[model samples]
Target: MFFKIFIFLLFFIQSSYAHELRPAIANLNIYEEDNITNATLSIRLNLEAIIAEVDINHSNTKESKQSDKYESLRNMSAVELLEKFNSKIKNLQNKIYLISTNSNYNLVLLNIDIPGVGNTNVARDTIVDFDIQNIKDEDLKFFWDKNLGSIILRVNSPNNEDLYSKLIATGKKSDWFNPKNKKEVDFFDNIRSYTHLGFKHIIPKGLDHILFVLALFLLTPKIKPLLLQVSIFTLAHTITLFLGVLNLIKIPSVIVEPIIALSICFIAIENLFTENIKKTRPYIIFIFGLLHGLGFAGILNEIGISDGLFISSLISFNVGVELGQISVIFLSYVFIALLFQKRLWYRNKVTRPLSLIIASIGLYWFIQRLFF
Candidate 1:
């Protein structure tokens, strides 16, 4: 019966990947010369998601649903996809809105290049080059329509050699990007933005991190033990996260990802045979936290942190992540520990069972990530 139940849970967890959320990335490069402004925006996103967002009939379909037409689009060669986009360039342009302080300028479709075939596992980039009259004197803001997934925007200003990046959600407009605007973000505002980034990473997005933290939570029934472990974990990760962002310490995802999965399995499995936190557990957690911190840095590096705002952004993001971690701990206490910690059967029925499930998932992830 135990084996049957475990199998069922494993299968259920495997099926959950179909509903996973993926964010789109848009890299916008704009430069002005000779009174003309040229812009090249390269957007990388899942073709099926974009199709579901744009197609009238399929717009209402859930992104997880498999579509034959969408698969065909995904299989198309770069030239073929470019041709199709060229034919419907106007419609595509309308989906992304750009406005200057004084007037809205149209983005003329110059060219499109879809990635070459052979990496179906990865999202493809659609390069769109266009030009508009130089709006150096005015503020410019841009946004995409609703139903498009989260967007990471990178803006390059040639005038001052400043690079600005921000995460913009669907239907949300970006901050005004102007070459002449030399103003640095206020400390409080920097804290607010980066803190949100850090929090969002953990709450809705950081499933792996959540599992790791949960593993730590199940290690002992007492709050003191858990708090000590969490504090050490936080400190360890903070150090590596800052080092990783500064490029002083670097580890590739290929190595770090699988090790992280294994760490989750290790902690959760150890909980089955141990009732109290071991003296060595804190050290182990600290090491795992270091790995997790590198993971966090990878995320920030992807969306980017401006050179000028680096220190403030890093500190704010770390604080937000700590808040997120605390929230997770609080939720675990309310939902699990408070209700079951005192029960005679808690160890056998609650902690062991849940730890086994978590360990199984972690082991599966380890195999999948390392081999596949």
Candidate 2:
């Protein structure tokens, strides 16, 4: 019965193609010259995704309804698409909200550029530039349109030549900033933001990490064994996460992702043969955790940690990841181990069966990532 259920889930998960939760990037350049505060905002995003978000008639339009038209837009030259995008400038402007200490500033569309023709399988970058005037040098708050996916805001001050960056969701504004002086983000605020980033990565977005943790849980029902493994895994990943972020060690995602998937498969396969935790299991987990840490660092590298608060950001994010991992283990204990650990059929029906399903998915990912 479990084997049949597993087969169905494997096929279902593989078939579903949901929109990826990739982050869009926005670069904000703020500088003051001749008693004038000038701001230029350049936003890069997936063109099709933005169109789908803002176009009210998109569902009924050919771009959304017809695959061929969508492909044409995707493959259109950067200049060609920029011309088409000109019509939607107002809609895009309405989505980006900016406010200064003295007054709210309107973003005027300056220009738009698409990098190149993109395809359905690959996302293309569409860059939109905006001009802002009538701004004071005081604290400024900025936000992107909520309809857009997650956005990573990079704020740069040409006057001082300093860089500050943060990730913000739709409708959420960023931290206040002054371009003239070194902006110091509060320690607690830094912790709060990065912690949320870490937790979100694990709970909703970190499917691969979730599966890896689950594979460890299936190895035993006892808390002692689980805690020992979890502690070792956490320590191992923390070491490499910091190392990778500092650029002391660099491993390309092409290699790291496949290896991470293989680690999941290895653990799940081992569970099928070993009922008790193996003496070498912790050592194996420690190694796998090192790879997983690099994965975590990859995310930080993308969003960027503020230079002023690098250590705080790193520690807070790691703390959130640990919290996320613990939550996974606790939930598994309640829903799986505590509920059926002593059942006569638990080993054959639950543990072994679930392990096989996880193993299958991991192996599938391994092959897909490695060869395809």
TM-score for predicted model 2 compared with the true structure: 0.83
TM-score of each: 0.85, 0.83
Off by over 4 Å in 2: 1-4, 11-18, 31-37, 54-86, 101-127, 131-136, 159-163
Give the candidate number with the greatest lDDT. 2
RMSD of 1: 3.6
The sequence of per-residue lDDT tens digits that candidate 1 reaches over residues 1-372 is 666777876765443332344556776677777866656666766554465344322312223455445556767887776666555667667877678777887777665556686544334555555555455566778788766656777777666354566778656788887644543546676679889989978885677788889888987758888899899989999999999999999999999989989998999999999998888888899999999999999988777787788898999999889989999999999999999999999889888988898899889978877886
Give the Å error, residue 68, model 1: 8.1
lDDT of 2: 0.79
Task: At residue 319, give the lDDT of candidate 2.
Answer: 94
Model 1 lDDT, full chain set: 0.75
- Candidate 2 residue-wise lDDT, 1-372, digit = tens: 877887886664443212233677888887676888787988887776565443322321233444455456777777777777777778888888788767778988887777765233445667778988757758777887666756888888875355567777655778887655566777897899899989878886677788889998998879988888889999999999999999999999999988988998999999999988888988899999999999999988877888888999999999999989988999999999989999998888888889999999889878877876
